[model samples]
Target: MKVKEVTFSYNQTVEQLKAVSLAVEEGKITTIIGPNGCGKSTLLELMSGHYTPKKGQILLDGKAIQQHSPKELAKRLAVVHQKNDVPFDINVERLVAYGRMPYKRFLHSPSEEDEKWIDWALSITNLQTKRKKKVEELSGGERQRVWIAMALAQKTPILFLDEPTTYLDLYYQFELLELIKKLNREYNMTIVMVLHDMNQAVRYSDWMIVMKNGQVIARGVPEDVITGERIEEIYGVKAIVDYREDSGVYVVPIGPCQRDE
Candidate 1:
C-alpha cells in the first residue's frame, strides 16, 4: 500500500495526520513507532480504510483503496484493533468463524472451505483447545490471540494491528510477537502494526516508520532509523542503541530529557 500526501483530522480542527506519506513494503513486517498520540494508530486506520484522508489518497496495488467495496477490502486487508469488545459472550471458534463473513453468502452457513481456514487460524494461534471457551473467559493474552485468530481466518494478504501487545505481560508479549513473525515468514503476509515498544519494533520489524505530532519523522530499515539520537528526538528520552552478533538492533532508554518547546 502507498499513501501519498495524506492528511486527516478528527474534529475538523485537530489534524491527526499531516501530509504523511509512506509505502508499505510487500511481504514484510513494517512497524510504526513513536510516542503516544503521535498518529501511529491514525495512520494504520487510514491505510485500512477505517478513516478517509482529508487530503491525498491511499492506493492498494496501484488502485485507489476507496474504490473497493467493504467486502472487497475485507478480502484483501484484515485489521485487529487495540481493543476488541464482543457485545455478547462468544466462543473462540464462533469468533474466528466471523472472519469468513466476507466470503460467505447471505443465509448460507460456513462451507468446508471456511472451516478449513478457521481451523488453521485456531491452530496457528494455539487456541484450538479453547475453541469452545467463551472469549471473555480467556486471559488477556488468550483473548488477544483469539482476535488474531479471527483476523487470520480472514485469509487476507495484508494485516494491520494496532498496539497488539497492550495489556500483556512480558512473556506473552514475546510469544505474540513470535507468532506474528511466524505468520509473516510462513505465509509471506504483509504486516503493518503500531507499536510503542522501541526495542521490540527494532528487533521484529524489517522497516520502521517513526512519527511525531502528525507527521512522519523518519522511515527506513530499523538499523538505519532507530538510533539513540533519533529515539531521544522522537520520544524525549535518553537511550542507547546496541547491536549484538546474533541479535539485531536493541534500544535501552535511560531517562527522560527536556524537549524543545
Candidate 2:
C-alpha cells in the first residue's frame, strides 16, 4: 500500500494531514507513532480509502485504490479500529461471518468456502469457545479479538489496526501482538498500525514512521528511527536505547531517563 502526497482536512479549513507520503511494503508490519492530535489516524484512513485525499492518491499493487470496486478493495484490505461497538444480539460467529459480505451477492448465502474462512478466523483469534457468545458478554480483550476475527474473515492481504493494544491487559497485549506477528510471518499479511507503546511498536514492526504535528519526522528501521533524540523530539520526553549483542537491535526504555525527575 502507498499513500502518495496525500493531504486531508476536517469539516472546515484546518488541515489534518499535510502533503504526507509513505509506502507499506508487502508482507511486513509498518507501525506509525506520533503525539496526540497528530494526523496518524487520518493517514491510515486515507490509505484505507475510508477518506478521500484532497491532494494525491493511494495505490494497491500499483493500481489506484478508488479504481477498484468496493468488493475488489474489500478483498484486498481490511481495517480494525481501536474500538468497535457491536449489537448485543449478534453472536461472535455471526460477527466474523460479516467479513465475507464483500464476496457475497444479494440473496446469496455463504458457501462452504466462506464457512472455511470464518472457521479459520475464529480459531486464530481463539474465539472458537465463544463463537456462540454475545460480544457484550466478553472482556475488553476478547471483544478486541472478535473485531480482529471479523477482519481476518475478510481474507484480505492487508490489515489496518489503529492502536489495537490500548486497553488490553499485559497478557492480552502480548497475546494479541504475538498473534499479529504470527499472521505476518505465516500468512504474509501486510500490516499497518498506530501504536503509543513505542517498545511494542519497535519490537513488532519491521519499519516505523514517527510523526510530529502531522509530518513524518523520521522513519526507518526501529534501531535508526527510535533514538533518544528522536523520542524526545517526537514524544516530548527523553528515552534510553541500548544494544543487547544477543538481540542485535536496540532495545528502548531499558533505563530511567532524567526527564522522569
Candidate 3:
C-alpha cells in the first residue's frame, strides 16, 4: 500500500496529518513511531481505508483505496484497532467467526469454509481451548489475541494494528510482539502497525516511518532512521542510540531536553 502526499484533518482548522507520503513495503513489517498526538493512528486509519484523506491518495495494488468495495477491501486487508469493544458477552469462536462476514450473504449462516477459517484463526492464536470461553473471562493479553484471531479469520494478506501494546503489562507486551513477529516470519504477511515504544519498533520493524507533528520526518530501516540526534529532535529527549552485538540496535533515553537547548 502507498500513501501519496496525503493530508487529513478532523476539523476545518487543525490538520491531523500534513502532506505525508510513504509506501508500506509488501511482505514485511512496517512500523510507524512517534510521540503522542503525532498522527500515527490517523495515518494507519487512512491506509486501512477507514478514513479519506483531504488531499492525495492511498493506493492498494495500483488502484485507489477508495475505489474498492467495502467487502473487497475487507477481503484484502484486516485491521485491529487500538481498542476493540464488545458491548455484549460473546465467546471466542463466535466472535472470531465475524471475520468471515465479507464472504457471507445477508442473514446467511457461516458456511463450512467459514468454520474452517475460524478454527484456523483460533488455533494460530492458541485460543482453541478458549473457544467456548467468554471474552470477559480472559486476561488482557488473551482478549487482545481474540481480537487478532478475528482479524486472522479474514484471511487477508495485509494486517493493520494500532498501538496494540498500549494497555498490556510488560510480559504481555513482548508476548504479543513475538506473536506479530512470528506471523511475519512464518506467513510472510504484510503487516503495518503504529507503535509508541521506540525500542520495540526497532526490534520488530523491517522498515520504520518516523513522524512528528503530523508529518513524516524520516523513513528507513531502524538503524538508519533512529538516531540520538533524531530522537532528541523529534521527541525532545536526549537519548543514546547504541548497538550491542547480541541485541542489535537499541535506544537509551537519559533525560529530557531543556527549553534553551
Find the candidate with the highest lDDT and give its number.
3
TM-score versus the correct structure, for each prediction:
0.98, 0.93, 0.98
Clashes per candidate, residues 3 or more apart or on different chains: 0, 0, 0
Off by over 4 Å in 1: 259-261
Given candidate 3, what's the lDDT at residue 192?
96
Model 2 is weakest, by summed lDDT over 10 consecutive residues, at 248-257
The C-alpha stretches of model 3 lying farther than 4 A from their native spots are none
- Per-residue accuracy of model 1 over 1-261 as CA lDDT, tens digit each: 999999999987799999999999999999999889999998999899989989999999898899999999999999999988974888999999999999999999899999999999999999989999998899999999999999999999999999999999999999999999999999999999999898889889999999999999999999999989998888888998899988878888899997668
For TM-score, candidate 2 versus 3, the one ahead is 3
Decreasing lDDT order of the candidates: 3, 1, 2
Alpha carbon lDDT at 227, candidate 2: 81
TM-score of 3: 0.98
Ranking 1 against 3 by lDDT, winner: 3
Pairs with backbone N, CA or C atoms under 3 Å apart (clashes), candidate 2: none
Tens digits of per-residue lDDT for model 2, 101-154: 998889988999999999999999899999999888899889999999999999
lDDT (Cα, 0-100) at 54 in candidate 3: 98
lDDT of 3 by residue, 1-261 (tens): 889999999999999999999998889999999999999999998998989999999999999999999999999999999998864789988999999999999988889999999999999889999999999899999999999999999999999999999899999999999999988999998999999899999999999999999999999999999999999999999999999999889999999999873
Q: lDDT scores for all predictions?
A: 0.93, 0.88, 0.94
